[model samples]
Target: MLRKPTLLLAFGIFLIGACANLIWVEPKIYMPGSTEIEVEGHGINGPVDILPRGTTAITISHEITNAGNSPVPAGYQITETVIQWVFQRNIASVGWREGDPATHTIVQLSQSGPALDPGESAVISFGPFTVGSCGLFGETLELDSTNIVVESSNQDNEDKHLFFVPSNQIINITANTINGTLYHKDGRTLTHQFRINSGGAGNQWLYTGFSWIATEGSTADAVPAPTGRVPQGPAPQLINMFVTPKDHDHSPLGFGPSVKGKVTAISTDGCVVKQKAVEVLVEHD
Candidate 1:
């Protein structure tokens, strides 16, 4: 665990309508000392950088302080405290609700200590817990806590942490002549060769099809067209599809004139669910 600067991004809300005033600071967790990287629109904070599969990036270290002018009053001494998670969508909980299972308490301290003098402080460390890799690679850890707010200083007790993970699938492609013919004579065809590699475990990707923008006067036939749903492979998968045109009369394009096509990978595997995408350029001639 690395020791780095901590962020104190805070917020407060007041409501007098049918609803009530709500004040909260989203919870978050990350590697010991990672950069402040965030994904947009997830929450107040963005996601951190991590691996696609199972990885550990959760940590918590918070301080409790007594900032009163004098020693904490006997009646106002801190009493109960807790640290836990608040699931916004309740995905893991049945009728899934935020803060459900009531048993999800990570830490609870009642009558934790004797009265402390002013300017005193205490430290609490909750975890270095293990988090599995699942779902899209972005937001992951979020932590929330509720403490008896005898002092206004501790009102901010929420932290929404986002764990950022990158794509683990690796793919390589080199443009080659189609049907062993660089230029289509009269009855030859052109094709693009794709060499794909799934780098880590559970990295299977399915080739749904290819999407491209063609100029008005261009005409070419791409193998495994949009309707072709070819399974990518286990790991280090090799595939050949039709798309690139031959160079001039000797180009790979079997039917149309030489054309450079920008290709985006389309898939319907776990890759799609995890928001992983790969793009390549296939040009011949």
Candidate 2:
């Protein structure tokens, strides 16, 4: 058994050692970092650019991960993300802003309670922000913009994305001459060539689909016309379609004078219509 003073001294020494250990030992350090690139919409495979017509606003999504060995406290769940957009047409300028053009936009993208544990990831979506114009546009996203989070690495906190919106003249239509003939009509089949232009990034017609209609003004033939559909492939620049005039009259419109006709195309998505007139030479038997 130890004496009272010796026991007291031992207890004091133990306490001192405990205090030293508590003070000197390193505390658990956690850091939240963004691992995936920010995308334009909610879905992972959503379009980054080539937005549909009449799209005035959009949303963005990104993933954050706790890359440390410890856990992040729920108390520090405040969001400090910043998103900025700039027009990229002929001249670069500021994109559309909701209220107070002078003020910047701050986004909140925090998850619900339950602290973020190590190796855990959380996905957050930000915005319904304006889509300034129908042209090339650029935007920047910076996570932890306020610098409130103590991160081991700050280099990966920023990302940039470019998107495009097309004007009303998204596609161009043209009639090509077939085999030396200005506009050839084989039997009753009238062939016309069309070229679909992409709206900077993706073909706008691909999403909505397209159809064509041809009318012969001179003869008013009552032949059934073929149904039209937008062609799909790896990348299609030009497409040709054969149209038949509806049955009505077989009156001779004269070969030398040519057959005056018009081709009309309408997009399935927005009902955008484009018309092209052509003169064809028919060798009717």
Candidate 3:
């Protein structure tokens, strides 16, 4: 027979072993670092149709699931997700205009305050928020965890997609001054004038007629305009004038020569030209 003390000691050891086994086998969940939480499920839906200067409701839903087995601590808070509007290479957190749904458009479908349990999940819904004209917009979801991951609809399977639209208006061209003896290749000097249309940037222009040559001046810096030979006729014409926004080396509203002309001379003041008598390029507003 075992002594009472020996028996008690044996029982205690057995209990300790059992407890250790339970700890080792029982599913455990650990809190994910701030960087560990990954936000996905944007392009889960296809491209959203947007109207020009109009607002549309869009739903962006995402899921937060615990990949780990351990239960996360209680009372962990998930902050609100943010959507960014990217337009014409510009990004803003706010909507394009007032009453626009796209601006800070966040609708919480579920509470983000509670600590998620192991193998549990959370769902978030944003928008019905307005989106500005047809263009690219990106959404990023952030969490209170140390491991934060951001996902965007523009990104797919590690690839990025761009959303952009062509401007409705065509390019505008303007000649501040045409101070030169415009001569045709046949050596006939003639008078010339330049004009431009008013509108947003990136408009296109079409020219027909005599070939024109254009050069940039110190203050007359402008983009190199497209050139073509003038059609043979009483009136020569050039077609298709393409204009882009002001570039560092180009005009503020887009500038280029509309006629096919030879560079007779270029001085610090301006350029001298010889053309077959080109027509003034037409501007599409």
Candidate 4:
């Protein structure tokens, strides 16, 4: 038989041990920091069309941003895969060439200096890539192109651009001068030529606007009439016109002596594709 005091003490100790076992404690979970990479189109620096038998240089610029909460390690490589599609020439309908395959050119760009912090951005440029003459050329640039970077999402890493290459000829404008000098005298006529060398793949129809302006502070004896938005085509066409100068130099209508002939080619969407301007200095002979 145990003493009363000792039995009570032992029971109390057991109750305390049981109460401790009943108590519940929550656990703390540590989630890892996530990293995300993003690419956006910045700007494109190139011509809309490449001349026949000539190559055009193209450059694509983009901005890379760290979109997640974690930092991206420095020296990590980012890849851009470029796919080129060449269009068929002389096709009645818009079509792409079958033989010319998409060239999966892989270009690698690396992060320099310190690691890219969260919400940080960097500008990157790719190519001055030489594109040969074709009817139309299309390109798709996929960033993180190789899936090399472990990002939060890979869906929005692509950008696309286009170019038109004239297989037959290029849109051109020129003037004819007997001895390389065009004298802008009253009643003197100058011959101007506009050549529309038309066949292209993507954008077949081009709108050209012609205007003549005199440089500021000089007197212009004559101004040519505007050729409002002429649509050019698949068939080659050449236009010749003459501009005769009035006695504007002595009148208030004359602006300047230096004359500039500006020809602008625009697309269907109102985008200026090509612009050519030439200035001539005329003296009273």
Off by over 4 Å in 3: 1-55, 80-111, 132-134, 145-285
lDDT by residue for model 4 (88-124), tens: 2231322333223435332333333225576776665
Please, what is the whole-model Cα lDDT of each candidate in the order they appear?
0.35, 0.41, 0.30, 0.42
Tell me the number of clashing residue pairs for each predicted model: 24, 8, 45, 5
Expressed as tens digits, the lDDT of each residue in 195-237 for candidate 2 is: 5454454444431222332343324221123124442222434
User: What local lDDT does model 3 show for residue 127?
Assistant: 48
* Candidate ordering by TM-score (highest first): 4, 2, 1, 3
Name the best candidate (by lDDT).
4
**Which run of 10 residues does model 1 get worst, by summed lDDT?**
13-22
Which ten residues in a row are the worst by lDDT in model 3?
Answer: 264-273
Q: Candidate 3's residue-wise lDDT over 55-167, tens digit each?
A: 24454444555444444454443433324332211122111211234554433332343345555765544444444343334333444333222211212212111122222
Stretches > 4 Å off in candidate 4: 1-55, 89-92, 97-114, 165-168, 172-285
Each candidate: RMSD to true structure? Answer: 15.4, 20.7, 20.8, 20.0
**TM-score of candidate 2 against the unseen true structure:** 0.35
Best by TM-score: 4
lDDT minimum window of 10 residues, candidate 4: 20-29
Q: After superposing candidate 1, which stretches have Cα over 4 Å from the reference?
A: 1-36, 42-53, 56-59, 67-70, 73-116, 128-149, 164-285
Residue 51 CA displacement from its true place in model 1, Å: 8.1
Clashes of 1: 24
TM-score, predicted candidate 1 vs. hidden true structure: 0.33
Question: Cα miss at 51, model 4 (Å)?
Answer: 9.9
